[model samples]
Target: MRWPFRIAMSTTAVMLFDQAVFAGQFLAGTFGALHTHRANATYSGIAVLVAAAAAVPLRWPGRGPLWPVLACLGLFGLIALQIVLGFQRLLTVHVPLGVAIIGLAAGLAVWSWRPDRVAA
Candidate 1:
């Protein structure tokens, strides 16, 4: 659980950092530079999400096992779809979904590492 939490936390942090960078790239009007960071954050986010999903069944301190796993899967699916929407240049969907991901990932990471959750 700790390991998974750490991975999830790291990915969220990556997203947070990249978002700022993305904004900078946008402001600078260098769309090309954004891709590398975008790719890095997305790919790494997916990988860490997988790791956290795998950990869900191992020893999740939470009362229900499936909820955590499902949550991870749900977020994973959303992010996977988000990538597709991005490549297709669907800002209508992509930008909002990215915001969702940032919030969800950050929320989960904070929740996971909370002292109370770990104590349980």
Candidate 2:
């Protein structure tokens, strides 16, 4: 159980970070949006580090709570949607999905450290 969950969580976190990094590269080299893209990459990097921290104990016998895992799942889903929308240019500026992603990532990271954390 721990192994499976840890693998899933780690994979998702890496995916999240990878997606953001790709977006940054695209923005900087192709789209000429270096500053904004760099910021995005930074956020994604932070998310990765936080997620990694959470995953640390998950590899052990007694690990994280449910909310953190849920948060990661939710955040990953939303980010996947956002990534798809990016390809379609369907993401609107007024929409704050990016901010939401960051918030969820931060939330999940913090929640993962909670003593009573459980899997759902």
Candidate 3:
């Protein structure tokens, strides 16, 4: 129980940090610093993988934080797909997926800090 909540908060922090870095990447692209794109994508993929892995321990006994864990996994899947769509310049799916990731990650971040939420 304690582990899930702690891991959730930790991963949520990663999501928050990733969002910030994502915004910076946008800025970099705007200024023609395109070199950071691949680097950013690499780090973003790594962060998503780490978050997904952290979510595994959340499935221990008790109420089972299923949806959050699934969401993290789903986010990772969408990101992988997003990368492909992006590489193909399929802006239609890629853009919407990016927005979804932002909203989901932000929601998780806020949910993690809820005072009423208990670990045990």
Candidate 4:
């Protein structure tokens, strides 16, 4: 269960990083990159949802803390809002929110790998 959660978190973090790369390419005048970015945003959102699902068993049986579950849910909500902002071309909020999403995803991945902390 822990390993599954760790993998999910790591995958989500990587997806978020790829999202950033695509965004940068789009900003650099690559029109096709915007399409890729939008597609990856959906994938990233799915990945976060998967991570959240994985986080459930970690806490349900009292094998771990509940923060990861809550964090993943919160992150997913932010990603949902992010997609809306991007579609609206609201860069003022979208840009910073994207950064925060990546940070949170990466932090969760890192935390998932910490055996002691994950089980606590």
Query: Which candidate wins on lDDT?
Result: 4
Q: Give the alpha carbon lDDT tens digit for every residue of 1-120 in model 4.
A: 688899999999999999999999988999899999999999999999999999999988857789999999999999999999999999999999999999999999999998665332
Colliding pairs, model 2: 64-117, 65-117, 65-118, 66-118
Query: What are the lDDT scores of the predictions, listed in order?
Result: 0.66, 0.52, 0.63, 0.92
Query: What are the per-residue Cα lDDT tens digits for candidate 1 across 10-70?
Result: 6655665576577478769988767775676577556657656655744555443455566
Comparing 1 and 2 on TM-score, the stronger one: 1
lDDT: worst 10-residue window of model 3? 30-39
lDDT of 2 by residue, 17-109 (tens): 454555667656756454555455445545554554555555454543445445654565675566566656674831367656655554554
TM-score of each: 0.72, 0.47, 0.66, 0.93
Q: What TM-score quantifies how close candidate 4 is to the native fold?
A: 0.93
Ranking by lDDT: 4, 1, 3, 2
The count of residue-pair clashes in candidate 2 stands at 4
Please list all clashing residue pairs in model 1, or write none if there are none.
none
lDDT of 3 at 32: 39
Model 2 root-mean-square deviation: 7.6
Error of model 2, residue 19, in angstroms: 10
